[model samples]
Target: MIQPLSMRGRHAVVLLVEDNEDHVFLTRASFEEAKLQIDMRHVDDGAKCLAFLRKQPPYEDAPSPDLVLLDIHMPRMDGYEVLDAIVKDDALRHLPVIVLTTSAEALDIERMYGMRCSSYIAKPLDFESFTKAVAQLAGYWLNLVVVPHRDG
Candidate 1:
């Protein structure tokens, strides 16, 4: 008989694609302060994000992310390109991606939705608002939503 998996020890893997150091720190701190029980892996560029997801070369042991928090503007590939590639890849397309960026451009929002982003959220400038938003997002995605298991 197969042993049951322990939920306490199994934390969701989150891939954060962000280039700005300040933003990264803020995002990390916000998540931590929110008491989220998940493993967050940071990628400074879209290329590295893709590489990690694909488990290419040096990232051979990288875990497949349960969710991806993407920033629209980044060096190398950018969020749009990364999203497109993810959608195109049969093995990775099922992974949920949320666009968490400072961009309020209508075109960007429309295009991201068209490409099947789980959701698009504009980053709040104020620390309080930012923390609240991050906490809510974490609660909703991690608790409310029924994510597909890795084997599924």
Candidate 2:
């Protein structure tokens, strides 16, 4: 299992905002296979994601996530809008948001970077490659990088 950051004093928490069920399943399985000891939460759309982050109504008891994995395509609201909201919010701006999507368009990449997304990862076509990528990603964030401590 991955060690929790010393600053956080507990297991890492991650929020995954994805509408595709298949992607969600694969992501969850990948983390499990890697034995990452993280609290992963899921929300299907941008609106719900925002609500969860803001701790509104149904998500009033939601934990503040250390990182967010966002998908670009979704109904109602898109990843760009959600990122914008997060960057603009004073309380939420410190969170890291990584874009994990199928699109690898130059324009999309440039736009996400312009909006201050922490990282952008295009989903691999093959299942094995995707699994490997997810493992690498988890290792990088959980073990390699230093992230801010989020109080519950």
Candidate 3:
């Protein structure tokens, strides 16, 4: 088992599982704008995110992320499937998962909450609101929340 590193009052590492390049750029920019000193990793698909989390083969040197921002719609595997897998895995279940997707459907929200997502955020269609939302999310998760550091 891999142990989580102790953070010296620094922002936690965040894994962003998103498929759209535009959204990725915007999200990254928002994080920077938020002034949160996070070590961010972006995976284009849920499958790659899962592989990275498992530290399998090529991901042998991968670090366990403190939080995950998952997109509901993606190729290969959707965020719901990824969330299900994470919650089921003993080693990864404790890590927080936040649903950051464009889907605002009640069913999606309920299902994600049922699967134990820490939070569910609907993506804003407007660019300004999107930026603000991202910034707020960063502020809340990286600054307000006290997360557990797991070491094995």
CA lDDT scores, all candidates in order? 0.87, 0.89, 0.85
Candidate 2 per-residue lDDT over residues 39-59, each given as its tens digit: 899999999999999999799
Q: What's the lDDT for candidate 2? A: 0.89
As a whole number from 0 to 100, the lDDT of residue 67 in candidate 2 is: 89
For residues 14-114, could you state the per-residue lDDT of candidate 3 as single tens digits? 89999999989988888887676888898999899999898886777877788899999999999989999999999899888999998999999999999
TM-score for each of the candidates: 0.92, 0.93, 0.90
Residue 25, model 3, lDDT? 90
The candidate that wins on TM-score is 2
The predicted structure with the larger TM-score, 2 or 3, is 2
Residue range with the least summed lDDT across 10 consecutive positions in model 3 = 1-10
After superposition of all CA atoms, the RMSD between model 3 and the true structure is 3.2
Tens digits of per-residue lDDT for model 1, 86-113: 9999888988899999998999999999
